[model samples]
Target: MNHWLMKTEPDELGIDDFAHEPQRDFMWDGVRNYQARNFMRSMQPGDHVVLYHSSCKHIGTAGIVKVTRAAYADPEQFNPDSAYYDPKSSATEPRWDAVDLCFVDKFPRIIPLSELKTLSALADCALVRKGNRLSVMPLSANEYKAILATTNR
Candidate 1:
């Protein structure tokens, strides 16, 4: 299965928020960037994800999630009242897509971005590349394991 790093603002929907959800899962929506939206569309059920908390006091990987559902039309895109609504989009031609993700495990402690930059194993990770801002990015299996190893240490 593919692995990915999905960034979210803790204040908006942190790992804790998912834990409290009735089904401990939520639809990942409102991705306006075409590249990011495409990444979500590429996800499949059971794909692994690293939940990264960004734009927060502690910017880091906070937890893990598994894709519970594949790509589907993002309802928000068709709702005029929603912030993510696209005026040009219609029910028959949705402009965005979303996936369902289920909480897997919260890290014992956040794997800080600063710490990530120091790891040689992740030097090539897209998330660590300068000026890279895509909210969702692919990660190699080795990169995934390397980050998980940091939590164990």
Candidate 2:
């Protein structure tokens, strides 16, 4: 199965929020970037995802999410009043896509980016890459294993 990393602001929907959800699942929406949209398009059911909490203290990977639904049109993209609206995107040719995700696990202590910088195995991970700001990215098998190993789980 494909491995992926999805980052969200803790204030928006972090690990604790996911864990507290009734079904532990939700549509991962509001991504408006083209590259991020393409990554969602590539996601598939059962794909393992690293749920990272970004734009918060010690931004880094926090937990795991399972892709429960593949790419589908993001309804918010069509609403002009929505914060994620894309004027160029149409219902027939949507410019955005999103996937449903199910919370699977969380690290006891956050595997912060400060610590991730020391791992040679994750040297190529997009999350660790300099100037990288995409909300969603792919993770290599080795990088995924190495990062998870460092977490308390």
Best by TM-score: 1
Q: Tens digit of lDDT per residue, candidate 1, span 90-120?
A: 8888889999998888889998999999888
TM per prediction: 0.95, 0.95
In order, candidate lDDTs are: 0.90, 0.87
Model 1 global lDDT (CA atoms, 0 to 1): 0.90
- How do the residues 1-153 of candidate 2 rate in per-residue lDDT, one tens digit apiece? 989999899898888887887375698899988898898999989999998888888688888889999999999999989999989999889988989998788788888898898899988887888899888888889988988898753
TM-score of 1: 0.95
Residue 71 displacement (Å), model 2: 0.6
In model 2, the Cα lDDT at residue 58 comes to: 62
Which runs of model 2 end up more than 4 angstroms from their true locations?
none
Off by over 4 Å in 1: none
Clashes of each: 0, 0
